[model samples]
Target chain A: MKFLSNLINGISLGSVYAIIALGYTMVYGIARMLNFAHGDVIMVGAYICFFAIYSFNLNPVIGILMAVVVCTVLGVVIEKLAYKPLRQATSLAVLITAIGVSYFLQNMAQLLWSANPKVFPTIINGSIKLFGGELSISRTTIVIVLVCALIVVGLSIFVNHTKMGKAMRACSEDKEAAQLMGINVNKTISMTFAIGSALAAIAGVLMCCAYPNLQPTTGSMPGIKAFTAAVFGGIGSIPGAFIGGILLGVLEILGSAYISTELKDAIVFLALIIVLLVKPTGILGKKIHEKV
Target chain B: MAAMLEVNDINVYYGSIHAIKGVSFEVNEGEIISLIGANGAGKTTTLHTISGLLKSTTGSMSFMGTDLMKTPADKIVSLGLAHVPEGRRIFQGMDVEENLDMGAFTQPKSSIKGNKEIVFEHFPRLKERRHQIAGTLSGGEQQMLAMGRAMMSNPKLLMLDEPSMGLAPILVDEIFEIIKALNKAGTTILLVEQNAQMALSIASRGYVLETGRVVLEDEAKNLLNNDSIRKAYLGG
Candidate 1:
């Protein structure tokens, strides 16, 4: 019964990471740059939602939508202001700029909202009991898992079937060639960031609802963990992110429940090291071939 | 023949080094015009500039009456112009059909079906391997895919850069034949080639580019027989 309960909790947590990791992976795949500030964007999304619902007394659904909208716009603005100019710059320079952006966002959040932690409201409350109350599952877990499934399926269809989605894939492979094909490379890249940040916003709200703790630093740890999940599953593969996140969550929860709570994160990182040493490409990362 | 594309004194630079110095040429409607040059003779650069991939320091470029210099590279295709770049830069990560779909990026979805049919008619091999990843295809098939992908836009003028590059001799003959057939079907061709003989053979007119300058311009037959052109380019 405990094992089943832990598994459900792990899935609920994993779905949040998967959502956040999707943003990281997509941005990395198309922009060819690590957006280190992604986690901070989640914090921003949470704050937006917190204010919209708690302060403004808006409905939870409206708060979530507003968060998604704001995050999407913020993403486009960040790309234009910070990353676009560094398009031709070296990877190291871009990495440093991303780190800078991350710090900037964190500091901005601290200044705007103050450093105090707020209790995030229970947006969805209730639990489902199975097997005569031996195993219980939270409604939030069901919602997060369903939302994650929908996002994964919807994103797959969009990338495979839509015109703009194909353009994004084409741009990732060869931007110059995509330009010749009459694809607006810059616009496609901006769209990628937009989509990624919107996902980040949802991840933020879901994470806060599950844990019910809102603070400037709430997004950073989960953001890094989701990034690890992305790398674990094969950074650029959509299915990989989902798998990686779920596995990471399961591992973390099982480690804490069975072994030591303080050592769960360490166990997760150690497992990542071992997996990378074995496969190097994560579970689904394609072996890139250099064309002569 | 009415001029479909006109360039008046365009100079292109890579940083401080001038690659194309005051180069100018034009392609008439429904004619195969060849730009024959050795390596680094600005053939690809000229094509890049006209397609808006590379900006010219000074010049006027008009394609179907639109000022090409002021237009974006991606917008050039909708104005009925297409370029098959040097080295067949087809989207290698995508499948054959996905690559074709990308080729029709600027076209309407309703027209995509018709455009794809036109492409398949030209290269039936692409249709057979439509689901296969592009990078896995043979060199000749990749070249065919590149040209067929360009044709997906249904452009009035098609610029081909080194369509014969790094292909088997038999494949080269096959590609050239297709170029002639495409031209016969009323698509204006601007062919750039290092293989001077094959380029001039099918072209109605030829421009012999030497060190970023159009050294000689004449009818294809005259350029094929010119003593200097034969010596420098045709390996006489």
Candidate 2:
């Protein structure tokens, strides 16, 4: 019963990481750049949600909506202002720009929100008893899991069935050919950033609700962990990110509960290193073979 | 009659290297115009420039009276112009059906089904492998997919670059036959080829390019029979 309860908590936390990893996987898949600033975007979203609900006395849903809107705009603006000009530049150059953007957002958030941590309000209260009250699952955990499932399903359908989604896949394969086919490459990439940032907003809110500690740097460690989840599942594969996140969360939780709390992160990363050594493409990544 | 496509004195540069120097040509409606040259003679560069992939420093290119120079590369396809770039750049990751869907990206959603059917009719081999991953396809089949993909947009002016580049002789003949059939169906063709004999045989008119200059221009039959052309390009 204790093991099952731990698994549920791990899954709930993993769901948040999965949501965040989706943003990292998608932006990397289409734009071919790692937006390190993705974590900072999460912080901005959380701050927005906090201000909307606590300061303005808005509803929780309205706060989430505002966070999504602000993050989406912020993601697109970041791509346009920082990344677009470096399109013809090298991968190293682009990577450096992304790191620079990450630092900029971190500093900007500190300036606006200050360094003090704010307590995140509990959006969903109460818990459900299971196994004759021996096991308990928080309402927030269930909501997070449900939301994650919905997002995964919705994204899969959109990518497989929609026109814009087809365009996105085409651009990922060959930008020049996609252009010849009349798919606007720039617009598709911008849309990717928009969707990714929107997901980041929801992730930020859920993450804070779980930990209840909000600060400018709240997004950084989670963002990096989610990035690890993306790599664990396979960098460009959506399903990979989901699977990777859940497994990472389980490992981290179980490791901390059974072993040493101080060494849980190290244990999680060590497991990743072992998995990568055996199968370098993450568990789900396809080996790229270019035909001559 | 007005030309279907016209390019006047286009000068294209690859940084410091002048790739296409003051090149000029025009394609009239319902005609197969072949540009034959050895490698690095700017045939591919010329096609890329006209399709808005590369910028030209000095040139006036128009298709059906629209200024192509100002048009963006993605918008050029909606203007009824399509280019089958060299190497048959089919999306290797996508299936055959998805590739066709991408081909008709600019067309109305209602037309995708009909366009796909037409493409299948032209190359029934593709219909057999509709679900197959494109990267695993044989070279000849990949070429067919490339041409069939270009046809999905129902282009008024279709530009083919090195369609027969790495195919067997029999497959080359088969591809040329398809080109002729496509032209017969009223799609104006601009073919660039190193296979001068095959290209000229199917084309109504031909231009012989050397070092970025059109050194010879005449009816296809005339160029095929010209002594210098037979020696230099036709390998007589």
Top-DockQ structure, candidate number: 2
**Candidate 2 accuracy as lDDT:** 0.92
What stretches of model 2 exceed 4 Å from their correct place?
A: none
Q: TM-score for every candidate vs. truth?
A: 0.97, 0.98
lDDT of 2 by residue, A1-292 (tens): 8899888989999999999999999999999998889988999999999999999999999999999999999999999999999998999999999989888988898998899999998889999998889999999999999999999989988887888988898898889999999989999999999999999999999998889999888999989899999999999888998999889888889889899999999998998899899999898988757654
Which lDDT tens digits does candidate 2 get at residues B62-98? 9999999999999999999999999999999889988
Error of 2 at A168 (Å): 0.2
Q: Residue B206 lDDT in model 2?
A: 94
Off by over 4 Å in 1: A288-292
Model 1 C-alpha lDDT per residue in residues A66-160, reported as the tens digit of each score: 99999999999999999999998999999999999999999999999999999998899899999999888989999999999999999999988
TM-score of 1: 0.97
What fraction of the native alpha-carbon contacts across the interface, defined at 8 angstroms, is recovered by model 1?
A: 0.72
Listed in order, the DockQ scores are 0.70, 0.80
